[model samples]
Target: MNSIKQTCKNVKTLVDSFLNSTTPIFCTPTDEPKDTEAWYSTWEDNYIGDFLNNSVVKAGLKKIADFYCAKQLDVLLRHSSELKASSYPQLYRIYKECCKRLGFVKMPKLYITYQIFGINALSLEVKGHKLILLSRMATIRLNEKELRFILGHELGHHQQGNLVCHTVNGLLDTFNTSSEIFGPMISDTIEVPMKRWCRQSEFNADRAGYICCGDIDAVTNLFLKLGMESVCSAYNEYKELEDAHPHLQTRFTELKKIHKTIKVNR
Candidate 1:
């Protein structure tokens, strides 16, 4: 665990350095409205309202991604130190390729780890700067293409710039991580919406990932290896949403829809 913590600290340092040097597109404080009501009124019933509503969701997604990346980095440093030095050089390289292919000039940093608990695969941090985290164990379990897609998914969160989501997530962590006794009702109220937003944000990220990966098979196979198929089978057999991720069929369908739109525009 000491090694894991050390690795996490190093990754955090790297992320801080990169963020310090990089200027964010939307980090400026504008005279724009702060509340959802004002935003909706200003947008005049456009999709911007939905975008504002999604702020909290986006932030939460970032926190989750950051935590997952930290965990993955720890795991990678512990189990695959040599592979980290050898085979994993391509990890960030492929991610950069994917980003460039998708027209993202500033590729988000990819932090790797062995494992992460809870329902996180990857996440992005958008507080002042953008950082991404990936599970090393998850990456090792996946093929090159899938890994790239996963990283792209996290980058999507960074692009989304959802600080409200991150704040809620941070609050939840504070409640759980602390010794304070919070009631189930309050916890449930905060958690349910957060989970729903997380699922929705993932769909958006899937679109981003598909665009970056540029290969449907690579993205689909990554989901499959992440146990999507098993979850689908279980849901069919038992009638339930069994996994944290969106249903496999739904995710695939959405990706295809986005891919078609992107191709038409291109």
Candidate 2:
């Protein structure tokens, strides 16, 4: 109990220090972001890099990815169907076009699952193979522009080298670390930074969606629906800090800012 408390206190201190700095302390900062989209500078610079330099954290993250990636691939093979350019030519064409427009040279293996029930998508790298899982709900509900946004967002994670998604991909496998140190490691180092990075990373991804699709309304609507923002505003608080992603309103507002900038620049 004391250890957890102390660890959280220490993390808070580091967070404060990072937030106060002009530059983040990450080892490999995105020196040149491939996507010319905007960045959430304050959040990214503060919360997105400590784990990159930590050996213990890296080991734990790798363990999670290795353990779960294969299983996820296996499960997808069983439950999800791959959308190939040969089999689904039109969809494949769209995928290719999205990659071309987004400046993503390499395409990730893409899959779509039925009855997904949620408007969601995921990007992960398994055994050096990058993959994107686009849910059926997204296909049904989101327009082509919105689809471009979703695709761009997922691909953006790849561009950002989103290491944490590798860790998150394993979450469904009942995350139990093989090493005993992992528990302490989580409490001691990984938890808070991971939370912040995951959230901050979403900003960069959203920028990708906005830039690639070039439609703020579509992007904003996707976020608004995903968070059930209307429902939340009526019943729940405007924002929930515990969420891995930012509030829908916050995301939409940020997109609006981007829209304003684009308009002014034009």
Candidate 3:
């Protein structure tokens, strides 16, 4: 019994260390864009990059990304449409407007998958495939400005080095089914730190979106809508108390402050 306990403890430590190591952010092959200098502070990227690039996390992510690719593939396949200037001219127009300022060295392939329902866009980078999934509901639900926020936000992840965090998250979820006994423990140890990182990383992405759209109201409205969706009976003010994002109020306040600083500096 003691040996088993020791073994468990050792395994947990190893997993924790693996998850905490930093992975390098994804970048283009040559003449990489340094746009993050404008949108995100180096400290912000360093803080989270330190944890996301961990060898274990990166390895696990490489292994599990295929699961998500397979699971959501049918829906993705249906769309079969990649948005570009030639193909989806109108939508591509909006994407380009946001892309240039956001400083993406290369654009990720955009997949517009129509499911009967679901409102979301996703950024996934794994094994050299970078993709953005724009769902049907997102197209229907968001207006031109809101869509700009969404596009910049996704690009923000790429630009600001936040996608590895998402990749690490995918690994945890993918393994939850098979490793029930150890999964929860591994999940808890990483959650708090990851939660903290994710929330901060979100702030980075939000700021990037603001820079792209140059509209505080559009960005604030985007988060406000999500916050209202997540609201229960009470509002939590503690920054660390929330899931991978700051509360709506916190975000609204912080973003306002950031905008003010930017205006002053400019």
Candidate 4:
């Protein structure tokens, strides 16, 4: 535990140094041409590079990614319903707008599944293939701008190599079936930092969402509606390390700071 905390601290120090030296802003004018070349240098989360370079994290991710991808593709083809522009024009338009703003030349395939309860969204990558999945409940519950924020957040995951985080998560979901095999393969060294990186990836995605929608109020209202405030207040550092996402409080607070930065820069 002490070593994990120390590692986190070291990572924080490096992140702080990187942020100090770079402009951590993504709220650019959409009218300008997509600056794909400058995307990583100008707007990427500093933590992504650090975590991706970690040998243990990379090995663990590589081990599970192909298997997870095959599993997900099977589920997508067999179980999930995909959304196309011909049938879902409004939703497709919003997705296209996000892709354009993010400068994605190759659009990801989009899929949706109906759920009796809960609102959720996720993105996946298999090798170079990218995909985004949205719950029908999410589409029904969120307004257009809020929906854009959600979609953009998924896109954010793809943009920053955060896709591997999803592979880890998917592997966990199937732990009952695969645990005997995977449990031996993934060690604490790999799992701990990978989880830490998972949490950090949310910040990057939130920024992408903000960039896509350009509406801080929509972002705030959506999070509040998701009940972030009630759940986040009680969360602690230890709990945060175990969880895949940052406390809603942490995410919203960071978004608010980014909002302020956007205002000042504009």
Worst lDDT 10-window in candidate 4: 34-43
Which residue pairs in candidate 2 have backbone atoms (N, alpha carbon, C) closer than 3 angstroms, thus clashing? none
Q: Give one digit per residue, the lDDT tens place, for model 3 in 149-225.
A: 78877887777655756665656555654796966765555545566677776777767666666777776677666
- Against the reference, the lDDT scores of all candidates come to 0.53, 0.63, 0.64, 0.68
- What is the TM-score of candidate 1? 0.55
The sequence of per-residue lDDT tens digits that candidate 2 reaches over residues 1-266 is 57655664564565355434423224566555354333422245532265343544444444446555678567775778787878768767877877776666567788888635588888777655677888978877887877888887887787776644546523622332555655556633555555566677777777776666777667767776776354446333433453457766766666676555542110
Ranking, TM-score, top scorer first: 3, 4, 2, 1
Q: For model 4, how does the per-residue alpha-carbon lDDT over 158-220 read when each residue is reduced to its tens digit?
A: 877657756766565456246776553343434645566677678878887887878888988
CA lDDT of 47 in candidate 1? Answer: 31
TM-score of each: 0.55, 0.69, 0.71, 0.70
Clashing pairs in 4: none
**Positional deviation of residue 256's Cα in model 4 after best superposition, in angstroms:** 0.7
Clashing pairs in 3: 21-54, 22-50, 22-53, 22-54, 23-53
Superposed Cα deviation of residue 29, candidate 1 (Å): 8.1
lDDT of 2: 0.63
TM-score of model number 3? 0.71
Question: What ranges in model 4 sit over 4 Å off?
Answer: 1-51, 54-63, 115-117, 169-188, 234-237, 263-266
Q: For candidate 1, give the lDDT of residue 247.
A: 73
